[model samples]
Each structure stands twice: as C-alpha cells, then as structure tokens.
Target: MTNVLILGANGQIARQVIAQLKSSKAAMKLTLFLRNADRIKDIAPADSTIIDGDTTDTDALKKAMKGQDVVYANLAGSNIEAQAKDVVSVMDALRIKRLIWISTLGIYDEVPGKFGEWNNKTLGSYIQNYAAAAQVIEHSDLDYTLVRPAWLTNKDEIDYETTEKSEEFKGTEVSRKSVANFVVHLIQEPNLEVKHSVGVNKPNTDGDKPAWY
Candidate 1:
C-alpha cells in the first residue's frame, strides 16, 4: 500500500479528502500532521495515523513523514516558504518523491483583470506567501505537482477542469470539496505527468473562457 502523509490535516479540504478516501475502495495507507488532534479526533479512517504536530516544526515533520511515499501539503500563511523548505529538507533526506501541494490562483499572474483583482483583495497576504512557497517546491528535486485553485469555498460538487500553470484560470471559485477530491486522485493514480504545476476550476462555470483570456 502506498503510504500518504498529509500536512495540515485539520484543514477543511484535508478533512473532506479523508472522508472520500474512507468511502472508496482505494488500498492506501494514510498519515496526517495536525497541531491539535482534538479538532480531528475520530475523523480519520481506522487504519490512518494521526500524528499530532505542526509542519513548520522540522523535527515533528520529519518524524511524521517517516516511511511515507507521498506528502500532501495544505498549509498556509506568510511563513509558508520557510516551512516548505523545511519539509523539502526532510523529503530530501528521506528520498520521498511525491508531493501534492495546494497553491492559489494569481500566484504568478495566472489571474487576470477583475478576477485577479478579486483574488488580490480576498487572498491578500496569503497569496503572496503561497507564491513564495511554490518557488521552494519548483527548485527542489522531489517530484511535485502544484495545484493552484481559484477562490475557495465550501460547496457540494465535482465539476472542474485542469490546465497548464499560469494559464488563465476559468472560474471565479472552485469548491473546497473539488480540491479535496483532486488530492485523492493523485494518491490513487501516482503515475501522472509529474513535476509541473497546474490550475483547476469549475467547468462551464466561467463562460467557456476566462474573461481575461
């Protein structure tokens, strides 16, 4: 079984992803890093390991990553770049390759016109930090897939599209649930075009083309 290590397991997308994993016939091992396990207690599948800690803490992250085949990072904040470097260090030391990292639209001018404006106003400092974090992964040797999603919200659907990075993202927002399901897809397939960043959004929801396109 491919062991999957998830950082920021307490996040909304992370939790929903775990839920989908539980219901599926996927034969994979799961581990999680959560600062406060209480928040996610009784939430993971019975066989999944819930390691209590923070991703920014290098020592904790290393220990949590032991024996894992892939790392799914859902962390946020201004210090994201530094923490990502720390996690990459452990991945390097351990020789683990797969990393599915969540980033945001407009990280590198992907958002355009009014959509970019909306992302800037709402994401604010977080997008800048996320941009820096993606840079860390890009320079690393670890096999990586950076998933940049447009505005996030709690919704119930799975109709979306994917494109090469910096391409005009075609939706104003994608449900957090769709993002979660995408993560699970990576874990199951594990053989896609690797080492490239991609953009995701709801299909037909963007008028057949990005307004900026």
Candidate 2:
C-alpha cells in the first residue's frame, strides 16, 4: 500500500482530500499531520493516523513523515517558504522523494490583464511567499508536483482544467472540491506526471477576478 502523509490536515482542501481518499478503492495508508490533531480527530478516517505538530518543526515533521511514500502539503501563510524549507529538510533527511505541494496562481505573473492586476495587487506578499516556497521545492532533489490553484471557492461541485507552467493561466476561480479531487487523483496515479508546476481553474470562468471577489 502507498503510505501518504498530508500536512495541514485540517485545512479545507486537505480535509476534502481526506474525505475523497477514504472513499477510494486504492490500497493506501494515510497519516494526517496538524499542529492540533484534536481539530481533526473526529473527521479523519478511522484507519488514518493523526500526528499533532508544526510543519516547521523538523523533528516533528520527520517523525510524522517516517516510512511515508508520498507527502502532500496544503499549507499557507507569509512564512510559507520557511515552512516548506523545513519540510524539505526533514524529507531529505528521511530520504522521502515524492512531494505534492499546493501553491497559488499569479505567483509567476501567469494571470493576465485585470485578473492578474487584481490578484497581484490584492495578494502581493502571499504570492511572493508562495513563489519562494515553490522555488524551494523545485530546486530540491525530490520528485515533486507543485499545484498552483486559482482563487478558490466552497462550491459543492468539481469542474476544473489545468495549464502547465509554460502556458498562460486561464479562468478566474476553481472550487476547493475540484482541487481536492485532483490531489487525490495524483495520489492514486503516482506516475501521471512529476517535476512540473501546474495551474488549475474552472473552465470558462475567465474574468477580472473571482465572482465572489
């Protein structure tokens, strides 16, 4: 079975990923990592292991990552780069090579026109920090897939499209459910693609900004 470790386990998208994984038929073992496992104890699948600790704490992260085949992070914040560095360091020490990292669109100025302007203007520091984190992962020796999701919403349905790093990002927003589905797909199909930064969004939603914004 593929042993998977999910960091920031209580996050909206991360929780959705767990829910989807629980219903899947893939032979897998899941470990949920969070600073406060109590927040997720009741929600996580009974078979999943829960680790309570900070991702920035190398010792804690290493312990949680031990023997894991894949690491998926749904982390955020201004110190994201620092947190990612810590994760990378521990994973490296443990010789864990597969990483699936969540990031955001507009990090590379991929969004065009008003949407790009608005995203950059609104989330300047967050975009910068996320970019730095992605860079850290990209330069690491681990086989990684960095997902850059557009503005997220709590929509109940899942419908999304993707664009590679070299392509211009399209659409304005995508549902968190869609992003979770994509992440679960990656866990199930380990070799689909690797070492690429992908942009995901809802098709035909191209606009100046997310509708909710």
Candidate 3:
C-alpha cells in the first residue's frame, strides 16, 4: 500500500484531496498532518492517521515522516520557506522521496500580459515567499512536483488544464476542486510529472484578472 502523508490537511484543496483519496479504490494509507488536530478531527477519514504539529519542528516532522511513501504539502504563510526547508531536511534524512507541493502562479514571472502585472502587484511579497520555498524544493534531490495554481475559487467543479514551467501560465482562475483533482491524479500515478513544476487553470477563463477582481 502507498503511505501518503498530507501536510496542512485543513486547507481547502488538501481537504478535497483527502476526500477523493478516501473514496478511491486504490490501496493507500493516509496520514493527515496539520497545526491543530481538532480542526480536522470531524472530517478526517476513520482509517487515516492525524498528527498536530508545526512543520518547522524537526522532531515533529521526523515523527510524521516515518514509513511514509509520499508527502503532499499544501501549506501557506510568510514563513513558508522555513517550512519547506524543514520538510526537505526531514524527508532527506529519512531517505523518503516523492513530494507534491502547492505553489501559486507568477512565481517564475510566467504569467503573461496585463494579468501578469496584476498578479505581481497583487501578490507582492507573498509571491516572493512562495518562490523561495519553491526554490528549496527544486534544489532538493527528491522526486518533486510543484503545482502552481492560478487565483483560486471555491467553485465545486473539477475542470482545468496544465502548463509546464517553461510555458506561460494561462487563464486567471481555477477552482480548488480542480487543483485537488490534479493532486489526486499525481498521487495515483506517481510516475507522472516527477521533478516538474506545473501551472493549473480553468480552460477559457483567461483575462487581465480573475472575475472577482
């Protein structure tokens, strides 16, 4: 069975991934790691394991990393770079490869036209923080897939496309469900997109900014 550990399990996208994985027919084991165990206790799958701890705590991370086959981190914060470093260090120490990291679009200045400018201005320092975190993952030797999603929506649909790191990011928004679907796909097919950064957006939604903006 595949032993999957999810960091930031309380996140919207991560919650969707957990639901999808639990409902799937695949033989898999899930470990949900988050800052507060009580926050997710009601929704966590009965068979899954849940741990409450900060990602920066190396001892906590090491405890969670034990016997895990894959790590999916859906974290966000100003101190994201430090979290990334800690995760990479723990995974490296345990010799457990395979990581799926959630990042945002425009990190590489890959968004085009007016939307690109708006994204840069809107995100500002937040993008810089995420970029630094992505850099840490990219520089590591682990098999990693960085998922860069466009402005997120809570729409209950799963419709999206992907762009490679080399390609310009498309569209202005994608649903959290869509991003979760993509993450589940990657986990189910572990050999796909190893060591790649992907940009995800809903098809035909291109514009200067997201509709809500």
Candidate 4:
C-alpha cells in the first residue's frame, strides 16, 4: 500500500482531499496529522490513522513520517515559514522525498495586471509569509510540488487550470474543492510536477479581483 501522510488534515482543502482519496479505489494508507485529532476523528476513514500534534514539533513530525511514501501539507499560520522548515528538516532526516505543498498566489508577484496590485495590497504579510514558506520547500532536496492557488472560494465544483511558475498566474479565483482535486492528482501521480511550483485558477475568471471581493 502507498502510505500517505497529511499534515493539517483538518483544513477545508485537506478535508476535501481526504474524502476524495477515501472514496477512490486507490490503495493508499492515510495518516491524518493535525493539532486537534478530535476535529477529524469522526470523518477519518476507518483504515486511516490520526495523530494530534503541532507541525513544528520535530519529535511529533518524526513519529508521523515513519513509513510514509508521500507528505501532503495543507497547513496555514503566521508561523508558516517555521512550520515549513520543520517539515523539510524532518523529511530530510527520514529520507522521505515527495512533498505536495499548498501555497497561495502572488507569492512570487506572478499575478498580472490590476489584480496583481490588488492581491499584493490585500494579502500583504500573508503573501510574504507564504512566499517564505514556499521558498523553504523549493530549496529543499526533496522532490516537491508547490501548489499556488488563486483566491479561494467555498464552491463545491472542481474546475481549474494551471500555469507554470515562469508564467504569469491566471484568473482571479478558484474553489477549495478544485485545489483539493489538484492535490489528489499530485498524490496519485507522484512523479508529475516534481520540483515545480504550479499556479491554479478557474478559466475565464480573471478580473481585477475575485468576484466576491
């Protein structure tokens, strides 16, 4: 069985990914790691394992990394950079490569036109924090895919497109479900997009800002 460990598994996108993976026929052994295990205990699959611990805790991370084939981190916080460093360090120590990280758009100032300016102004330090976190993953020797999604929505549909890191980001908004779907794709095809950062967005949704904004 392919062992998969999900950090911050209680997050919306991560929850969606868990549900999708469980519903599929893929032979994956899931380990859900989060700060509060109770929050996800009810929803976690019977075959999945749940561990409650802080991502920055090296001892906790090391325990969770054991025998995992892939690490999908859907984490967020003001201390995101530190969290990224900890994760990378633990993975390197265990020699577990293959990481799929969820990041946000505008981290690289890749958004174009008026929307780019608005994003920078609106997100401010959040973008910086995420950028620093992404940098941590990018610099690591691990085979990683950094998924930079556009402004997130709670929509249930999963329609999205992607852009390479060198290209300007597209559209203004994408659904959390779409981002989850992309993450599942990465998990299933581990070799795809290795060591690359991808920008995900909805087609024809490009504007000065997200529609809800």
TM-score against truth, every candidate: 0.92, 0.98, 0.99, 0.99
Candidate 1 RMSD computed on C-alpha atoms after optimal superposition onto the true structure: 3.0
Per-residue lDDT of candidate 2, residues 1-213 (tens digit): 999999999999999999999888998899999987899987788889999988878888888999999999999888999999998998899999989999999888889999999999999788989999999999999889999999999999999999999899999999999999999998888775699899999999989988888
The residue pairs that clash in candidate 3, if any, are none
Question: Model 2 residue 63 lDDT?
Answer: 87
In angstroms, the error of model 1 at 108 is 0.9
What do the candidate models score in CA lDDT, each in turn?
0.83, 0.92, 0.95, 0.95
Residue pairs that clash (backbone atoms under 3 angstroms), model 4: none
Candidate 4 TM-score versus the reference: 0.99
- Residues 1-213 of candidate 4: C-alpha lDDT, one tens digit per residue: 899999999999999999999888999999999987999987799989999999988999999999999999999999999999999999999999999999999999999999999999999999999999999999989999999999999998999999999999999999999999999999999999999999999999989999998
Residue-by-residue lDDT tens digits, candidate 1, 1-213: 889998999888899888888898978888978888878777888888888898778888889888999899988767889988998999999899899998888788777677677667767888888889999999999889999886676778886788787467677767888988888898888767489888888876554233443
TM-score of 3: 0.99
Top-down lDDT ranking: 4, 3, 2, 1
Q: Each candidate: how many clashes?
A: 0, 0, 0, 0
Regions of candidate 3 where Cα sits further than 4 Å from its true position:
none
lDDT of 3 by residue, 122-150 (tens): 99999999999999999999999999999
Candidate 3: 10-residue stretch with minimal lDDT: 36-45
Looking at model 4, residue 71 earns an lDDT score of 99
